[model samples]
Target: MSLYTTTLLILDPDPYNSIDRLYRRVIQQAMHVTLPTGCLDIFVARPPTRFRETHFVVAQLYKISAELKQLENKEDIDVRVLLEGVGGFDIGDARNRSWEVVAVGKSDSKLLPVFIAEQHSSWFSPALQIIILPMERSIETSSRLPSLPSDEDGSHPPTEEGPHLGEAGLVIDSTDEEGGDLDDEGEEAQYPIVALGGTFDHLHDGHKILLTMAGFLTGESLIIGVTGEALLQNKKYKEYLEPFPQRCAAVLNFLAYIYPALHATTDEINDVYGQSVTIEAIDALVISGETRQGAKLVNQERTRRGFHALKVWEIGVVNGDANDQWAGKLSSTDLRKREFEKGELAKGQGTQQKLE
Candidate 1:
């Protein structure tokens, strides 16, 4: 039924007269829901002879909803409450924190009490109609098993950690005017959806480790975003690095055999700059929390451009190259600098599988 209609029915007089005593009124509103953790009492508005009684019930209801959701680990707990009077419910107390929705209507102050139940049930109407009834609570599973094997020295297994199948994603890095082909210039992305990014001027075992991770992450597609040469060089040495397309081609060749996504975009990735790319959508952006700042910047830009905020997931970093690779050793810029010349550029193929 429409919410307005339901509100009217709910506001109707109680089937049994309950004006004489407070005990009778309290019993009338004691609806309960059974959950795995405990039983939650749903409150219907009780006519309070005094204002203090109204305050007491409000405190009790908040405690109940908070306890229930805490057990479920659910963030989106909507509180469709009926306040005792208009302006009775405080927005601060009922917001995204413990509640996602609150539909309040007429009462003492044009407000009703909090929602009586969390679930709706289906029912039959007197006019020979199917009336869906509402419910309060239910028991549910909290944990699930992983899909991919965590062991090493095994064929790549599909994992939800990296990319999701058929999730549309895009990657953009400015390209020079090559071959003078407009269609070939800047195009939408394609899939096994590999997104190879970061400073490629020093593509080391860390890069390879990430490449291996991507192969497992996106089984059918990949997009290599070379982040313009200016952008990369600007990162450290303060100069344009690979001049864009060359970096793309280098990453492409190293990854071409394992990657299925053939397209790439420029700084315009995530539609912030406007040009669009085609390919599997990116379900998650896997990175070490080191890039947390950059990721947050990108996400903020996405929101400003009226796009969905990204669901960025952070992964732990593997140590040196040996660890980064199936060899299980540390491999990173710092380690590379300690061994080889600092800032020296290198490139090679990434592993085809996650190591032991």
Candidate 2:
């Protein structure tokens, strides 16, 4: 099969709720409609304000990609999760973020650009081939591209000279000849400081995946909020929870291993929001499914404090065993429970041997 690079823009509101179904659809589409193995850039356009929801979505996508690799026997499938800044979820923002994530230089020699969404939007470039899912129809045939805005004199602005159209219609130019520079042309625009918060206890596979994603999304630095001991006092399996300092150390170690070049800092958070709501430099916030509500609360606090809200990127819950009675994703609680059960079984076996 030919290698194809495609960027997918997901416009779903509750992507995590129907994760299994979404995964099936995505895999089916990838196998039948698009190339089975290539660079798949997935972007969730209107992610839930809650970090938990967003995290669930991301985790689901990660699981799906892994499953796809196993099923197709293609180990080289590159799947990247692209996140957008917090604000309006309009077509323009989605299109711009998509371009920003995939576009490297002025040329289109890398890969093919394809968009998949529930509905078609006019914000996409004319060169893009949009696929509307569930309906599974190409927007190129069903919808007409929107016309560019004209000046008061009814004349369209001159097209700025740039390099050849890239695979995903990425046009490279530092400055537009028509007037001012493009909004996303500066050095700072490429690398924005990002923040993420969690207890990060045990530092299992789930936490590792979340941290890995944060490292990827962050351009310059990653500010992590490890919940203080006081805040986690009421948590389940609190006795087994690692100390705040140890948790912080584990997080730092994991980040250093995955992203040796990234500048990562960890702080103790006593409250829910932490530095994400207070820090004005943070551009986005990475969250998992359990902390979704916390993200919304953080945004609310930011609004009250007259600070810009941080864009929240949610990751999905890692699925547990299929035969397990609990019908939810894998969690620290689950891990702890298994440990407790194993201890109890060991004790029972020792008692039986003594009696014998």
Candidate 3:
């Protein structure tokens, strides 16, 4: 445990790759590959076939994100953009009306990426990080993080020394040394594009880390997106969590209290130079470390289209109760049994007499 080892990986896909192409990008079919855990995310590819956009195209995403947040009880939905093609408001006006309102806009190239990442993050990873790629050739090709070597012994190596007490018995600086910096940037860095993605089911401690990281890095308002139930239609991972509607509500609850335009915050998401940059106007994105490769590629695509390539910002992973027996992959049948069993076990332990 003296020296810890963790590496960034990039998954390179072959055009002839036989792997289900659906997993390539975020889409409605996510439930297929992903387990039906209420809080997990899976990406899918929208095979390029032109489809007409309607009023509520991307509107569902914001609603979903907000609902998911509410279900978790944290209740803070910050940023979102939709692909409403006609019957509703445009992306620029995403926040003019409440998430409850309908929107309208054509499915632009950028909206899909945002929608996919958030929608999936709400369920798959919980700690959501969304990265949307404008449907333009920003980069020639994309890459992924190198896969890690699982411990053959069936256990993970110590990432670092266990937490240690500090001055006044405090757990001082147990964090990784190589974390993202807060104040490193220039003009180009200020207004850089970003790729945002996630499955933010029960926004927990780890999820907050990701959000904090994104806000710190961009120094501006962020853009968020998620998948739709119509697209998330049939999946495997939906057992022990709230549905999309509830999840999005949780998120919006959190955002209102924190950035409620009336709250007091020292570290506000100011513009590149302290300008007005709130959720209604996003210039950057917040993403999870679990999904850097796909996001990077999308950013590259934007660059090719004469758009600012996104500067990657990271939220260090935070831990949550999902590690408990109650939370896990969703099954069509009985997945909640784990939670029930754990509860029974606790009850039995309480009644057992302790031997002196």
Number of the top TM-score candidate: 2
Question: How accurate locally is residue 327 in candidate 2, as Cα lDDT from 0 to 100?
Answer: 56
Model 1 scores a C-alpha lDDT of 0.31
When summed lDDT is taken over every stretch of 10 residues in candidate 3, the lowest stretch is: 163-172
- 1-356, model 1: which lDDT tens digit per residue? 12111111122112121111212222122211122232222323442322112222332333334444545553133322233222222222222122212222122212222322111211321111112223222222232222223236322333433221111111111221221111111222222333434555444434543443343344354444545434433243334243455545555554442233323332323222212123225433434324544555554555566654433433334321213342432233343344344323322222323331
What are the models' TM-scores? 0.32, 0.48, 0.33
Q: Give the TM-score of candidate 2.
A: 0.48
Assess candidate 3 and give its lDDT. 0.30
Candidate 3, residues 130-227: lDDT per residue as tens digits? 22321212223232212212266423232222111110010101212332121112222333222244544555433333443333233333444433
**Which lDDT tens digits does candidate 2 get at residues 118-202?**
1235545444544443522211222111222346753334323211111111111333333222222122222379888888886
Ranking by TM-score: 2, 3, 1
Q: Report how far off residue 340 is in candidate 2 (Å).
A: 0.8
**Between candidates 1 and 3, the TM-score winner:** 3
